[model samples]
Target: MEARVMICAQTFFHRFFMINNIAQQPSSVPAGPKRAGEPEHTPHHMMVAVACLFLAAKVEEYPKFLDDVVRFTYHFRHGKEATEALMADKEGALKVEKDRVLTCERLVVSNMGFDLHVTSPHCKLGPVVDAVLEVAAAEGRTDLVREHKSLLSLATNFLNDSMHHLICLQHRPTRMAAIALAMAEKFMVGKEKIKPFPRVKVDGEMVPWWCSMRIVDDDEAISSDMMRRYMKDFHSQVYRQDDDEAIS
Candidate 1:
């Protein structure tokens, strides 16, 4: 469920960025620029983010009530005291906020051209993990089979962490799955919990374990160096956030 929400949020932000870029483009017809302060013309970021999450929940088949979404959004954006006061108001602020969210939802859908289907790397993680384990078993490496749960958990953690960075936007789902598995295997090997991944024979040539998974075609084959570069960037982002939190 968390994975689904994260994937949806990533898709929402991606579409949001695209919409902003298109909106900023110069119009062919000469017209006065709308004032940024206009209430109708300017949508609040919080409202749009909540709307995206609301729409994403529906898309992921985990529908949430709009009222619950709005309430939670307010609770998170404002503190408990402020939200309670707003909810108690007779001026219909909550109703107005709900209306704004609905309006933004339409804007989001229109800007997205009604394309809401989003494929997540989480879906690919399972198959990738299975392929690796199958190869390990084929090589008479029973140790990996025994550690299946741990391996899957580590890979899942890596994949979830990847969602926090723009690396998801930079790579396809298949590539992200491969990277997650690679990171997991590397971490396990570093801890001496498992032997390094065994190479598999592919078309008479020995190839890395990921090569057997068919994550990408030969033309789009990723190299070890490339994987390392991606992992480095991923770690940097994660650690940078940790440092910021520590300072805070």
Candidate 2:
């Protein structure tokens, strides 16, 4: 259920690849003291947001129709009150949006040095969740195995929400997947009174950079607690955007 909600919402912005941190991109760029004259076009927030949605429908395997994506995104951006004019004049709206999408897509593709392949954490979900469960079982914690299905749901939601942050790109899909599971475990322990086990660490990989970005004390694979902190920090960024949007 959570997965479906996220996948549907994500249909708009398939890959919002922003190199700049959310802290750098404010809702409104304030005028500063004049520097050497320059205003070269870079992909801004709205452009990247819409383009990701437009492109995702085409690129993702299940293939939502272009019309569905357009309408879905429109409602997502502007609540769910669509009138006849909005629905009837789809072509006109889409033509304008497509132009914006094209410009942003080109800039993003080029800006990232043409690394068009944007990896999503969805694929690595199974192995990551299994690792969590396996760790639990090894620790003689059958309670986690008993609630595996719910934890899987929680993990899916966490990964989906995590995608809202540009920091996701700094980590590999596998690392993102593992982080999602760790986050799920944290929620599971706190919400359901599940016995908190010792933090399970992934043996091989170094810690993801985002985890080290003041979220963790040292460079290490994020444990359950570190991931919870990371997500708390991450969601605050999303909330900031939401607040700005509401005001604007």
TM-score of each model, paired residue for residue: 0.80, 0.58
Estimate, for each residue in 216-247, the C-alpha lDDT of model 2 and write its tens digit: 22235455466555555554554443221121
Which portions of model 2 miss their true places by more than 4 Å?
1-44, 64-68, 75-94, 138-140, 197-248
Provide the overall lDDT of each model, using Cα atoms, as 2-decimal numbers: 0.72, 0.55
The numbered model that scores best in TM-score is: 1
lDDT of 1 by residue, 67-177 (tens): 788777788877899778767862577677767677778888888888888888888888877777777887899878888889889988887777766677778888888
| Candidate 1: C-alpha lDDT | 0.72
Which residue segments of model 1 deviate by more than 4 Å? 18-42, 213-219, 236-248
